[model samples]
Target: MNAELHTLTGAYALHALSDDEREEFERHLGDCEACTQEVRELTATAARLGLAVSVTPPPEMKAAALRRISTVRQEPPVAPAPARPVAARFRGRRMARFALAACMAVTAGSAGVAVWQHQSADDAQQQARAAQQQSEQLAGVLAAPDAKATTGQLAGGASGTLVVAHSKNQAVFVASSMPKPPSGKVYQLWFNDAGTMRSAGLMDPSQTTEAVLLSGPVDKASGMGITVEPSGGSPAPTSAPLALMNFATA
Candidate 1:
């Protein structure tokens, strides 16, 4: 894409581009990752700007403006005049109105940009907080005095370990040497509380050695199992478990 086309990024992000312009920019976006990321950031910013409160015009404002316009005489067509500087053409009220309009346009655009920046900052802060919370949870689990770890062999030569914090009703699982599931299928973890089985979470197929934070109540669970299920996972195990580990928790 041409350098000149890059200038339209802001307008494109704001959805101000014409149809043809937008189509061309979209094609350019596929090849240009930088531009694609910029557009995404600007679009998010625009969304934040849209949430701002707006002032309503007075009820009679439109009628009064139309009446004033009706009273003004239309100018007659004349031969083309020599080009003059924009500042040199307007005088008195016309000049004031033009300046005021220009100022308002600039202010509005700046305000929108400002709102986008503020929202971006807020999102970063929220992500940071979430990361900190996750770290703290993991630390607490590792530090538990009664936590026990056990390893067992799974089907297809896979091996897995389970670390449980019985008193805290929490557990983490780490799997290795697991075969990839068939297309449209994923491995899911399950916890057996008494005789009832409940889903924990799905395993990451891409990682040979992966750790997962198990869900459901661990204190009441007598055992844990793993089974292959459809991609989104199943409410109940669809097939026989490939691995099962019984826990004797206090």
Candidate 2:
């Protein structure tokens, strides 16, 4: 039973086996780690094939393929030697067919995985470029000659400065000293736009001193404030701000 089950490994991995054959193979898999590993790798490869983009083949592609096949010389089958047993020859042929089918399936699946990986790499590169451009824009705002800076202190002994570039409508928050928040809590920054409060960003409490880019247009904001919130942060201040700094109007 074990020897026969071993022969079904390729079929089992490709999910081509009958229910009974699959059940028997699974039972054998428990005692065979090599077959288990092969099946896992094959299954993952097959999953990658599902993620591949599908495209309609050109109308002429089938005709072109037939034309190429027609021109190829066909190999004549060689007669088996009289001394070779008929059953052994037939078994050899069956095993060869199974191996060929498994190889073709694996090759197609690998190609699909390669295409998916390439697309993922391209998406990551595009995201990195976008982040680099945003950083450069923020750096320009900080370098502006008209940028003004002011300091503010928090009740929890945390202090930071608000450096605003009025012309650019941007600001950078540089923490001179900030204590780490208790577990499950984080410090969040907000901009007071007139009477409405808008989220600027979250501050990293792990760092003693760090500069954070306050995203969004700052021209309309009259002041900035910070408050303790849950780790992921909140849309609105959940508690009273630890500190607040008002910007001087020119």
Candidate 3:
């Protein structure tokens, strides 16, 4: 409920709490946001901790678990055996028990490995999906009929084909033949998404034609503009546009 208790909540969730302290924090967690965040962070930390220590619970559980396994295991029917065969049968049973224990250990180890692999896979998938969603969003804007509003020429510049695209979201400015930006000076791009104007990017002029991507949410793009700006980019155009391409979506 309060910061002190909230901090203890983290310890509680992670099993780092003393018995009484644990009870106190658990009782308080019903209403605390700070506690909730800490609990969430600690839960993640605990999951990692759990993998570090794989001690099985209690011996009583092992007995019950073994009994459950025996109930499920199919035992071969007993047969009247010669005296020599009786010893062999006992040995065979021992071997089977040892093999079962071996199998269980292997299974548990495999499951632990599988869980870590699954998490890593899920993380990679999440990143890939995010990238794909962004690219798709960009593609939809690029493929829109509105994009034909203006024609971008791919000229044989000193760098490569100077291909450029423009839209309301922003101008997709790129130049292949252009040379890289000077040591400190960078090429900047601009777009009039509506009446509002904004600088697009500060990039190496030489690599400009390589079609670098930009994230935008833009409007009423009347013209595409490029300028020389400092590294990274600027929010607004500080200098004259080096190149201008005018286009209309309507």
Candidate 4:
């Protein structure tokens, strides 16, 4: 059983093992805490590795894929925040946000091409790059220390909600429930520190959102608000927020 441990990894990390193999590994791990730790470490590492990649997974495999992610070797823990914060809490939270966003960024960015396939052929080749741009914008906004999460709308009807939170170092924005913007006019985002509003990024069509996460961090922002801008994005918002909220910090 000890010699067979290595054989169980690839399948175990992805949870692809047969019943007997899984049982054997479980029993082996019970007596050998080292094996349990090894498995956990390997899974975390795998998930982390996968996060940086953009492979659209099949639309139907969302749950299985997310579940498997938690078990992967290189991935970090993506569980909900705990009740207490530790010394490394900032670092841990940063890692968690990036890992989650990175993974979703790939999938959501490409719209089920990488996340579903991870890199398999048959996915969109052009890369729904437009969507990727939008996700990147969301990440940028979330990183603001004064960022807050809530529902929003543009003058035209672009709508969604993102959670904006942060610490002294940076502001982070996480969003979902955003409808993809209209064709010519995108649901653009903006950051208004005081009176001047700066372009954040384009919002994807809201219909595509799936409770996926979006994040970003920025400096020199005392307060923030999202607004609708032109398709290519404007240096400043052309219209007011369809849905707006104040930063908790602000």
Candidate 5:
């Protein structure tokens, strides 16, 4: 594989490459298994990151946008030369109109970008807060006196451990060498309450091995199960369990 071409996987996944470069990379993908796998993973990651969680603009955002727009200086209209031919004067007028339209477009785009940046900042702050909360919950679960862990070797050379703390009503799944789900699919966790199964949470496709704090309380669940489900997960298990661990037997 061409080292330079291999490095374009990110750009190619985002469709940011030039036409010539895209064509060349497509050709390379046909013969390079590593590049093909990378492109698939990169494309999935980009799609996940591109999902927009709408955030309300701040109170002053509108005023700020207006202030930015007001800073744009418009060009004065040019007068056509009287001595020019009729066709030349007409063309000059059309050009002037086009230029004015372009300037207005640029001004609008600038304001839009400012608002977008503000919204993006808000989104990042919210994500950071959510992450901090999850970290604290994970720590609590880990510190529980009744916490118990079960480890098992899964198929495909993968292994995992399930840690549960009844006192905290929380459980965490730790995995190693877990295989990536198929395109448009994700690994989902389930809490087995008696004979019924309830959703725990969806795993991040970008991570194969990591500690995942299950979504809901697990005090009543007898065990935990993992299955391959469509992105965002399904209401019920759509396939056989990839792995299962009994909490009592841990």
Candidate 6:
């Protein structure tokens, strides 16, 4: 078995071989069990890869490739001469195909990276917009003519202040030196709606000192409370309140 022809399994699997080379390889495949097995495996892998590659390479990468191609000097025309040996021609074409495959792999990697970068940028933008909206709502509540505040102390020297604006029907909860919740738990805020407690919002686990705009209307609630609930929070308080503040007295 020719080692050179054995190597052609890759080119054949990729359909990179010329018609004559393909015919020769196919004829060779009849007697070569190893190459037959290799070709079968390579062909399956190529089919799988063809279906997987859908991301379009960035435009800048295409432009750069075109620029590189433009810079390559074309070989000058030569007087008619004897043709090179078929083996030598195959070897040269094989090397060129290998180079092309390497380039394609790099381009594919770049496409993946570009997709990740775009996703990161989109995530950052969404976070920024949310922050801006929260800030505006906080400002509206804090500056309301009827704005009032009620403060309460927690067990671990932590404190929370609830600011309510009856005119705006909005409320904001500010925490300072807040301790981390127990493992598998989170801090949840609630409004004392008449006698029933209604969920306001949950505090971010990552922040120790931060302000949150409570969810839903605050006009009916006469007080606010904080409690430790399971992760993702419960619809109702699962335990006693860590701290409570009376909005009616404030």
- Decide which is better by lDDT, 1 or 5: 5
Worst 10 residues of 5 by lDDT: 108-117
Where is model 1 more than 4 Å wrong at Cα?
Answer: 1-132, 248-250
| Candidate scoring better on lDDT of 1 and 4 | 1
Candidate 4, which ten residues in sequence have the lowest lDDT sum?
113-122
Regions of candidate 2 where Cα sits further than 4 Å from its true position:
1-131
> For residues 91-142, could you state the per-residue lDDT of candidate 6 as single tens digits?
7566666555444434322111111122343444444345435655766676
TM-scores for the candidates? 0.48, 0.47, 0.38, 0.37, 0.52, 0.51
The CA lDDT at 216 in model 3 is 52
How badly does each model clash, as a count of residue pairs? 0, 0, 19, 55, 0, 0
For candidate 2, write residues 148-191 as lDDT tens digits.
66766766575666777788888877664477888889989999
Best by TM-score: 5
Candidate 4's residue-wise lDDT over 1-250, tens digit each?
A: 3454533433454455567666665555545433343343334333323333324447779888889998989958667567743223333334443444345335443222211214322122223223234334434444343545544563344344444445533333333335556567766556656666655555444334332232234345544566556667777677876655445543
- Candidate 6 clashing pairs, residues 3+ apart or interchain: none
Q: Provide the lowest-lDDT 10-residue window in model 2.
A: 110-119
RMSD of 6: 21.9
40 in model 1: Cα distance from truth in Å?
23
lDDT per residue for candidate 3 within 1-250, as digits (tens), equals: 2334533433343355457655555555544433343343333233323322324367699789888986796879877666654234334434444344334334322111111222343444444345334344434444444443343443235321122234445334334345566677777766656645665555543333333334454445566666667777777776776666765444
Note the residue pairs that clash in candidate 5.
none
Q: Score residue 58 of candidate 4 by CA lDDT.
A: 73
* Every candidate's lDDT: 0.60, 0.62, 0.45, 0.45, 0.65, 0.67
By summed lDDT, which 10 consecutive residues of candidate 6 come out lowest? Answer: 108-117
- Candidate 5 on 176-208: residue-level lDDT in tens? 667788999999999999978899999877566
Q: C-alpha displacement of 112 in model 4, angstroms?
A: 6.3
Better of 3 and 6 by lDDT: 6
